[model samples]
Target: MTSNFRHVALIGKYQASSAGSTGDSSRQALEDIAHFLERQGCEVALEAETASNAGLTHDYPSLNVDEIGARCDLGLVVGGDGTMLGIGRRLARFGTPLIGINQGRLGFITDIPFDTYQATLSPMLKGAYEEDLRPLMHATVVRDERIVFEALAMNDVVVNRGATSGMVELRVEVGGRLVANQRADGLIIASPTGSTAYSLSAGGPMLHPSIPGWVLVPIAPHTLSNRPIVLSDATEVAVEVVSGRDVSANFDMQSLASLLHGDRILVKRSEHCVRFLHPQGWNYFATLRKKLRWNEGGS
Candidate 1:
């Protein structure tokens, strides 16, 4: 959905994702992004809760996710990559596009750095930035075939051991047929856009953002025969915790309370898609090169 620019919403880590010095640094980045977006001709909007913790003292404060999504054209999400995933899920329905500014380590999704905002995002606000459309996955964690928690993940939906070190035994099925049962750390159901995130960490191969493919990658599978499998966007995948050696999930780390043992995760291509604004002439591999230091030196 292309449109002329009007309202822009900003979301960030007001509290902390980790601990200690990392938390302090995240708070600072949140503040900087707010000021930067304001200077970029976009009024800042945030949850009342987020604003207070970030020491945000703006007279013209903003609204929360629901209100901002309804009114904003773009959401400028700041923080680590996790922050962008939260914003994307919270405001997924508004058809609102997002631009992420990376503030922490290993920001695979939030590819843009704070320093490059003006060079890449300015033209975007003026309706000049290019757009990349990626498919999102809708997941339902069920028990007894009854829906428990329904959520959206731009990356992968993982079912793995929680605190235990043992392999999480899972039974995978596609279109109601059994795929395999093996022991592993976890299983990753990832979108192409998410291939570089935890899925990659779990040994999944990197995929082009343009390709509409989903990957089933097992984390350190006990059997060598259990390899990463690619499926079309049309295939629906069902996974049940046949035998949970204490397993849990993290939906982009938004809410950990919902993930528990005996939970079943049903993943399929979602009707919703997230639009990303890239600078003119932005290339996927080129961005990866600079961000991942593909050919760069050991600094």
Candidate 2:
């Protein structure tokens, strides 16, 4: 551990390859950005699968996400918010700081826009910015006392009805106590880092970035009683689907889609944290104001 790093990993969206012409455009951005970093005197390592998507024969270094995070001072993620989730989860493993350049709209996670690539990245290479510590959530989607799909998220973990109109029922528990028998399209448990994301879309409250609490929001609940609830770090929360003929849960809304029945989901504050490299004088609330469109005395 060098207290900071020099080698960096660059991650992008492989799923977005089907985004019509936008896919080709996204792929090109990755190519241009990697070359940009190399020119900046940074050793850039890209995800192996990304090479395949680019139709390039070059091999990515044999490195897992954790290894990349451990070895690299930073992880630069290109593409949409989904790309941020993919790399953010892995970066949590070794507590690596990430710099996201948004190539997508709103770009809650991908805060820095592509147009500011040079301006935003130049200071980072020269070690000239502050690290905003962002919390991460660890989720385990399990069944029969066995781990099925385990992951960490800077945003949220979703347990939803995949490709089905019927709701997915779940009994919510906090610290081993029953909270609610949820009847909804799905459930979202998000960190403050994720509060602006799916949780916000699902009628969850907005949490300040440094709030140090977790938000549990039900997606499309059948009853109005179920509102998004925030919990402290010490609490242990579990969600178990009551019963279903065809049940599925999506972690992070998209990826880790369609899990099976009898699954018990566990969510907790991860021991690890994610540090983001922000432009100097970064203001979390000010950024939120711009993204959320909080007008003066208006909607």
Candidate 3:
């Protein structure tokens, strides 16, 4: 059957190929997936970085992120959640749909198992799938009344103290109102989709993906009274560097910028959202059960 998506972009986890054998495997996997996509009557292209890092020399066209966003109807990401997160943020603006094939340990977002991808993906390409829209957050660093740096985060925005530094003091605000003055090793502002990530690890609540909210969690606060809080997504959040040395802000753990005293990291809901295509009958709870071992002892 012809694919519902006529043009597809193949993206692999090239970072896993630090070893020679791993590189070969990554290259082979990309080639294999490309052939599979072609058999489904879809034109395939390799993402430029994936082709370069994996040393792919196939006759298929190699395209950059912008090119893929402009031309491809579907993006088939063959990697772990990190790979998906990276490409997801870049492609969100273009509104391209993505499907993930798991090659990493935790397949939270990359739900499809690699070994059985063929059986699962075939039908999905033909429009037999579930679609999910995940929102993104826009974060910016403002210094001296000017925006110094900015980026979009699909997961969380983190402000952390340097490894050698002591606790950092942060002044938090929500919707232009004073929230609290927190002293901690760091602070995490996570979207609902990121609740299971760094936020959960830092003692924040697990927010369902459908929730229109954000979680603010402190990392090892100096005062025991400082705790995690969930806020409405419509509200804007700002965390100012009150006192800290060698502090930095991370967007989705991908982009980073150093923060100085009085520097404010502003965060708000982004206009763009990522589109994920899951196999029919896919469930969020089912994914949590499998990935988090929630049903380990159940029948």
Candidate 4:
């Protein structure tokens, strides 16, 4: 209940105007938040890119991610989950707490809506909020036993067919043990926070944030015998291309890299975690019920 925050950083989409929400109109909503923070005697700095996108005047200070992470107590994201994902990956390494204001559709992680952001903003400024520490995944692609592409994902890492319409063959292993030889469109390795994302659309189960596990989902598996499985987050997963065809590896549905024959992808829980600050009264189940429209029917 101690509001020790002093410096705050504001980050938004490069083109906030692309969003239909008023929040993005000349970055008006972000300006409003900055004013509110200033009123609290907090030093506000905008992310350099976001400031440039908004055409911010020289009156306000703009800093890069590294500077903001080094100086700021909280980083505020004023766009959708996609924006949060990108910023989260960078800021998480600095251990800076992040708060999101949803300005896009289906903002599962960006919980605060533009309309009610002010109401929620007050408590957060006073250090009255909940914190959720989420895990990240480290992925590396190996060719001929040499490491090639590598990146981190806050959501899921997928090994998918590149251009061909046909399913691909993959050999999946857990902790150096053979798990399955899967023939499918692709394979998804998702963290608990990602269970509600691509994995969910692939018929994977929803995992609570408290679950210390990761999910393996086969996308459009050729056989009905293939089912989604949840394993300990500590488990390391290795996916090898059994077929001679090339495939694509995607991280968080953003970063992409091509994988050739004999290529292997190694995925494991990352030592770093992203910390999200939620307004008081925020409920994970409630958010899920609303987002998934689970309120429609129940047992």
Expressed as tens digits, the lDDT of each residue in 64-171 for candidate 1 is 788877777788777777667777776767788888777655365676777776676767777887888877888888877688788888887887776656777888
Clashes of 4: 0
* Residue pairs of candidate 3 with colliding backbone atoms: none
> Using alpha carbons, what is the TM-score of model 3?
0.97
**Residue-wise lDDT of candidate 2 within 112-169, one digit each (tens)?**
8888888777776777777888777778887899888777777888887756558878
Better of 1 and 4 by lDDT: 4
**Structural RMSD, model 4:** 2.5
> Each candidate's root-mean-square deviation in Å?
3.9, 3.9, 1.4, 2.5
TM-score of each: 0.85, 0.84, 0.97, 0.94
- TM-score-based ranking, best first? 3, 4, 1, 2
Scored against the true structure, residue 105 in model 2 reaches a CA lDDT of: 69
Against the unseen true structure, what C-alpha lDDT does each candidate score? 0.74, 0.75, 0.92, 0.88
Give the Cα error of residue 16 in candidate 1, in Å.
Answer: 4.9
User: Which ranges in model 2 have alpha carbons more than 4 Å from their true place?
Assistant: 1-5, 16-28, 55-67, 162-165, 255-262, 296-299
* Candidate 3: C-alpha lDDT: 0.92
- Give the number of colliding residue pairs in candidate 1: 0
lDDT of 3 by residue, 185-286 (tens): 999999988999999999999998889999999999999898999999999999999998999999888889999999999999999999999999988888
